[model samples]
Target chain A: MHISPTPQDFLDQSLLLIQARPKTTRITTTYSTTSPSLRAKKTALWLAKKGKPTPPTTTTISPPTPTTAPTTPQQHTAHLTLKTYDPVSGTTIQFVTREIRDVGRLVGVLGRAARGMGGVKTQPDTVMSDAPVPTPTPTPTPNQAVLHVAEADVPRVGSPAPTAARIGTPGPGGEKQQQQHQQQAGGSGGAQGKGKKKKGKK
Target chain B: MHQQLLSNEEFFQKLGLLFATTTKQELGSVFLTQKRLTPYDQNPEKSDTKPQEDTLADLALAETPGPVLVRATNGASKQNRDTKKIKFSTLIEPDAVDAFYVRYAEVCKSGMTALKKKNRRRKNKKKASKATKTEGASA
Candidate 1:
């Protein structure tokens, strides 16, 4: 029999899959790009706002450093344009983020946007209506744990084959288990009754 | 217990479910786009030569969210461009998405695995060399 994984397994795998993939240097959204000059102006303004006062160094300047470090695109800060649909606003919002290393945060942001639109945000109480299934393991991780949490940020209606197989198998296996329980119950009851009769005879 | 790694099919299957759930809630269609930079022409002197953007792939999860609808020029057999405007929706046909996911995962996983293997080999080599050097010095 092929062992099927639970939903937890799928969630863990998804996290690993995203984490294992190399961090993207740039991710472009369907949203239009802002003008380069406009972007440069904004950056300049930001830098100017955060600039530290420095002493005049024209007279006391040191010689220029001989070595220039080569900087790669990865070394350069990554700018990502993330587009998310806000259900409450009924519009797609596009924003830029320099922190693109964590996939969990990315998904959480998107999930929040989706949920704001009244999207399903909870795992269904019952995955399979027909079967008597065990309670879903209470996810110990907090909602803020983002990557590991089992919050239905991305609520799914149906599962893939693994869960499907488990759901389907219980139908046949469940009947066999019931039969075994009935037989065991009958045997134990007969044995108890016989013991009681012998005690009465004694 | 052997860990169950998410296979390409399973990954896509989960993605498909997510797409469906998102769309069913009346969210806007989700899309996966692939683009490649067009190579600049060697002879820049010709003013008439125009650089073009090469769109390798453009697929959108339909509003109804079944199989993905593939664009005509999906970097495949270019000869049969006029095949009834064949819609490559994942709802109608899941195999295309499955195949694409498999190939994409293989390419990405191979790159990651190769890098890891190279690092391991280098570490082993360094340890071996250090051991030999220590032995020689001791002798």
Candidate 2:
């Protein structure tokens, strides 16, 4: 028994089966490596189909013969079974991929592994068995409204208007200065309104 | 040969133990299978409470009917045919299983990179303080 130190090593050595039935979608994918002899047979068949003559064996150019092929392929071949279920119509549709040469290419069909199954936030369609049942957002009651108003007032009282140059200073002087600034601004506005009225009369 | 149902934490611990103890030759026998669980698998008695239409609607509005089951097994050896093979299973959210695989891959690629970064920072700080001390003494 060979122990794999990492997940990738484990994946390389063992068969991987993933069956997903998320919401309306249902799919199964299998990944397994083909033995060297099987790969050699495949290569021979492919060459025969293409009608290409077997090239002379050289030290540099390794032939795709059984003897020359590695003991095992470095990568796993993937097979996908897609099952579509319609609850309303009470119909189920199934589709399967004949062997995909490399599992990496299946990323396009399945999407990225991280986003697909990596986190709860990304996989909203799947059921979260251990997650706490989400409570409905409560409608704001009078008490809640009063608390909200109190919270809203705290900031207003703590931080006066921006006109206060020494804002946030812990003293009554800041508040007095802000009040004076506001009064000055109101007076200026009134004078400006009077000037505008005079210009209209002229 | 018996299949044992384990909690999430126990299952993870067992997996880690398997990873540590299994040899290269036994790697081929190790297998992890994941499958979606139906509502009936979750609670057989309660499954009858809701109509098919209502259940379907709820599933569509919320999430899938139930959690996913992940079974890990090491097949019996040829020499020791009667030996009890290792087998266990756990029910986990689909996304969590996916996240675990992703995290496992990351750990394999970079072993504790965050800790290495902290060590490097500490070394750099010490070097800077030593240099400053030496400069002050010379002055």
Candidate 3:
């Protein structure tokens, strides 16, 4: 059976190193002659920009001179190094390589792995632990509010006027019904009068 | 002395063995370096005499194929100074570099035995919880 090494064992055995450097390629170009016509055109444009009159075309143009300059182009390469040590044989070995792509993702993975093996606590964990636990405050639900009102008004359950007054204010349909009832019993005034009398008696 | 180029399989096997032998007390670190490769023509004067087409072709041919160089070293500690230090460097093909990273990452994440132990503990906990539920229902 192939037994896999533990993370701690792997951490102890190996080290990873990723280094980034800019690779520069230099290319030298030799120009045998600068084009006389092109140079003259450039001179004419410069004179115009400077608000000066253009020179006559009859003026002799200088011959092209040979010039050489080296141009360098730079690109980035990531070098990855892995070092491992053997305890049984007492031998240490190292491996190094350069990679041109996916350097960011590779570094991120390796960082996470190293932190895991080292048992390093991350910032987010410490922040979460230090934060206070939010205590839930009681919020009055619609049903609970109704129940509380009902309980308080239990003593006045025998009086219909007070009960109707309280219920009619909450519901539009109940208020309409109360209004129609008052209109039908024009002599009795309204439930409001009865609610007032009940309050007085209490 | 001539250095022998190790095949990919041989390199991986040696890497695995090295990892297998390392103990927990040792420290592991990773250093990443990125750089650009610039190709320089040695004979600029000679190239000037050649045709423009030939120079262009030469530039194309001179372009170096980017190869990843990997070097591994083991046992450089003060305590292990008496032991022999083994160091090997190899050029890895670009296509195979991804495989190497994946393997290295896997080894770093966790060991197979540790995962198995965790799974066994979880199973035992589940079984115990089930037995308690059955006992409560019976009582």
Name the docking class for model 3. incorrect
Model 2 lDDT tens row, B1-139 = 4588898777777765553333222222335554445444466446546657555654453333345565666556779766457788877665456555554333222321111122434555666667677768888
Which should have the higher lDDT, number 2 or number 3?
2
Please provide, for model 1 over A1-202, each residue's C-alpha lDDT reduced to its tens digit, 9 standing for 90 to 100. Answer: 1111332333333222222221111111321223334555577777678894433435543322111112111111223344323221233334443332323344343332222121122345574776776889665665557755454455555844456556787698798999999999999999999999999999
lDDT per residue as tens, model 2, A10-75: 332222111131332322232222333455668888988999965544557533333324433333
Best of the two (1, 3) by lDDT:
3
Lowest lDDT sum, 10 consecutive residues, model 1 chain A, at A65-74
Candidate 3, residues A27-143, lDDT tens digits: the string is 111101123344567789999999999977575543211111111111111233333332222344343333222233443444433332222333487778899999995887999
Model 3 clash tally, residue pairs:
43
Best by TM-score: 2
Tell me how much of the true interface, by contacts, candidate 2 captures: 0.01
Q: Report the Cα lDDT for candidate 1.
A: 0.35
Model 3 off-target regions past 4 Å? A1-202, B1-5, B23-65, B73-76, B80-86, B98-121, B135-139
Cα displacement (angstroms), candidate 2, residue B135, comes to 57
Q: Can you list the residue pairs that collide in candidate 1?
A: A87-A117, B66-B91, B67-B89, B67-B90, B67-B91, B68-B89, B68-B90
Q: Can you write out model 1's per-residue Cα lDDT over B1-139, one digit (the tens) per residue?
A: 2222344455455445433332232112223322111134475445223312111111111111122222111112357543212112222123244345344344322221111122434555666667677768888
- The C-alpha stretches of model 1 lying farther than 4 A from their native spots are A1-78, A86-202, B1-65, B69-92, B102-139
